[model samples]
Target: MKHLLSTHDLDVPTVAAIMNVADHMSEINARSVPKVPALLGRTVASVFFEDSTRTRVSFETAAKRLSADTMSFSASTSSVNKGESIRDTIETLSAIGVDAFVVRHASSGVPVSVTEWTDASVVNAGDGWHQHPTQALLDAYTITRELGTGNTLAGVRVAIVGDIKHSRVARSNIDLFARLGARVTLVAPGMLLPAGLAGPGITVTDALDDVLPDVEVLYMLRVQRERMDAGLLPVGGEYSARFGLDERRARMLSGDAIVMHPGPMNRGIEMVMDPAELPGSRILAQVRNGVSVRMAVLFRLLGDGQLGA
Candidate 1:
């Protein structure tokens, strides 16, 4: 794949290839020395136009695991402080010899525009409330490993809860899971949901309790107050009361059900209880699998095409 911009048009064969390669990368991660020479001569640059902790570090770690040289550009500390444009910054980095760019920005479609400015391969780390492809990738891998469901999620039932209007992860996951044959249900408050979100193989609801018992994968999302303008919900306590996954809802899940939340969780709001206390939690597994899945992505874009050859 030249660029992993979104999961919208990603084909099943390509998804299978990435998932299949991630299995090999996951094994490498479990080794005593989790390092490989697969990408020795390649250099990857992570350019984030916004703040991050997990996504930025995860991509760099993935690059390192494959022995790819890495560079990072922080907009806060870089020439961006001097009013440098994204195109200019990317052109500058390209001139410095980058083989790939893992880009994150606060606006949608930044990565797509970035492709016009450089010859290097581009992977959208994240762009606004649009998509976060690798996050969906790792979450898929984690769910597969957790459920022992090969590469496809044919019979699995997944419910994505909370802040769908502002969640890039939810957007990508909804596209990916449904395309992989999983039945998806999006649960959220009325105002939090974007228009035209429901269709074939997808369900939408404002009642969280009604779907709790039947969902096999309960994916939670934070309220994203940083992206909100005031007054979406009446009060924080009311939101927690209506949609939060507290101990009661946790008990509604079956023994095999897995609860997931992409990082930077709003502790008392979206998640009313500690995830550590829940036996079905795969939160840490998602974080652990991120490196291997991302390694698979980088290898697919930058490595010689021998994967599944």
Candidate 2:
């Protein structure tokens, strides 16, 4: 729990502890004075090398809720525009007393490299296709809340639909969900799915229909057009025609099945179904839980660790 670079870095007990803390963090929203003094003297730095709205603001809210001071830095207007290298930027930030770094970088493993340069605890907000640990954590919290207590998704089948090749969220969710005792089924076209990603408890398949009926959770991912280096699909219409989760496909789920998407969804591309209107859609809850889950993470990493103890 020292650093959250990847979901692969956390064991089952630590992951559960963080989730329990998030449950307590959620309760703070109900209090007359919600703010905690846990991170009173600490400081967190959010360094974004890519564009963001939700992730950045949620982490900022999380830090502030715990009474931690934050230094928000984005590469778009910073020394990065002056041709300053990431190394120099790290050195500059290190000159200030930064307690933790919540980093979102375009290149994979950049957060791990940041850890090498500073004593700050590194939480990988995202690192290209490498991982987004907190995103996975929030999604886990959302599912647990929806299912209620003593409801472990041990044998529950989950189908992660849509883009997989360039999604750090998808990669992190797959690993984290498996670790939390869910059976993960990855469904995407051959070109869209990552190669050599299968393991014992996980299965990779292009047959979406086969995976649909049995899935307890149908997680959709947005196709990242910004991350594309070359032409993978002919067109959006063609891609959707072949693989999108349309209304017909949405009907395949069981009565208690839930539909999920990490936001900024593409209407007709990855998910043809109206995710917001779906009864089982917990997308908005994922966004709210992002703040609480991150609050839990910040408190654990920077706080006194007695909030949920």
Candidate 3:
């Protein structure tokens, strides 16, 4: 647990430990001040090479909540624009006595590479079609909270729908859910799915209707239009009609089944049913849980390991 590069690096006990710490972190967030001295005097640096809204702000908020000093680095304004190398930039940040780096890069493995350049622990915010470990952590936390399933996901069936080829969230979720004892079904068109994704605790399919009735969690992904240069489908409507979680498809869900989306949602494309209005939607819950999960991660990596012990 020195660095959170991917969910694949975590086993069941470790995941449960993080979730337990996150439970306490969530309680702290519910207090009037919502601030703690757990990480006081520590400094966290957020370095994002790619565009972000939720993750960047969430990490900054998490750091602040734990009373950690924070600084932000955007590639557009940093020495990166002047062609400074990644290693050099990290070395410079390390010189400033940063305790941890919450890094998001357009290239896969940049965060892992950053670990070698600095003594600071690295939390991967995201990387190119790779893993978003924190996102998956928060998502799992959200599901456990809402479903009252505690920290274990045994026998829970989860279906991740759409854009599997380009979604780092999907990749991380599949790994996390499997490790936590959940059955994961990746639902996407054949062209959108990666090769060799189906085995063991995982399944793959293109037909959403067949899987909808049995799954307890329906996780929808936004169509990554930025990743799709050429048209992956004939038209948006056709895709939406077939794959999108519209009102009609929403009804197909099993009783007590929850809906989820890692957002910047496509209103009429990947999600026609308003996530906010959906009865069982955990979309906003995921956002709120993100702060707590990240706080737990920071505390685990930077603070004494007594929180969940």
Candidate 4:
């Protein structure tokens, strides 16, 4: 538990322990001041080689809420623009006493590479089509909170829809959900899902309608147009008409099923119906849980070691 490189590194008891700590963090978030002295005098550095909105801000806010000193590093403005290597940049920060690094990079294993250069604990925010551990943690926390499932997701059916080939969130969720005892079905077009993803506790399908009736959680992923160079989509409304969670398709889901999207959702593409208006949507709940889950992670890595399983 020295570093959080991937969800695959965590087991059931460990996940439950982290979720219990996050439950406390969630309570702190509900308070008027919403600040704690748990991480006083510790410093957290957010080094993002890729552009991000929700993750970067969430980590910074989590650090602040725990009273930890925080600094931000972006590739565009840093010495990276001057051709300084990532090792050099991290070594320089390490020399100044950074306690932990929350790293997001376009490269897959940048966070793991960073651990070789510094003694600071590394938390992977998001890597290129790799694991986004914190996002999956928050998602699991949100589901548990909304469904009253405690920390175990046994017998809960979750369907992750769209863009599986390019989504780090989907990868992390599949691992975390399966570990927490949930049955996961990946719903995407043939071109979107990578080969060799189906196995025990997991299934894949191109037809969303076939799985909608039984799924308790419908997690929609955005189409990563930036990641694809050529056109992977068909012309006009064909993709949406088949795959999008429009009002008509929304009605086909189980009555208590919840709709979830990570962020920056495409209005008419992946999600046609307004997520804010959806009755069982946990989109905003996921955002709030992001702060709590990150706080728990920081506390575990940098605070007292009591929370570790």
CA lDDT of each candidate? 0.89, 0.83, 0.88, 0.89
TM-score for candidate 4? 0.97
**Across residues 1-309, which tens digit of lDDT does each residue of candidate 3 receive?**
578899886777778888998999999999999999999999999999998978999999999999999989999889999999988888998898899999999899999999889888889999999999999999988888888889988888999999888889998998888888889999888888988677678988889999999999999998876544477753687888778998878888887999988887889889987776678788888888999999999999899633233
TM match of model 2 to true structure: 0.93
Off by over 4 Å in 3: 305-309
User: Between 1 and 2, whose lDDT is larger?
Assistant: 1
Taking the tens digit of each residue's C-alpha lDDT, what string does model 4 give over 1-309? Answer: 679999987788878889999999999999999999989999999999999977999999999999999999999889899999999999999999899999999999999999999998999999999999999999999998899999999989999998888889999999899889899999887888888787778998888999999999999987775544367764337768777898888888888999899998988878888876689799999999999999998998887543358
Better of 3 and 4 by TM-score: 4
Q: Report model 1's TM-score to 2 decimal places.
A: 0.97
The model with the greater lDDT, 1 or 3, is 1
Q: What TM-score, to 2 decimals, does candidate 3 have?
A: 0.96
Residues 34-114 of candidate 2 have per-residue lDDT tens digits of 898888888899999998878999999999988999999999979899999887888788888888889999999999999
Model 1: ten consecutive residues of lowest lDDT:
300-309
lDDT of 1 by residue, 1-309 (tens): 488889874677777888889999989999999999999989999999999979999999999999999999999989999999999999999999999999999999999999999989899999999999999889888888899998888879999998898889999998888888899999988888899777779989989999999999999987776544477754677888988999999999988899999988888888999999999999989998999899998998899533232
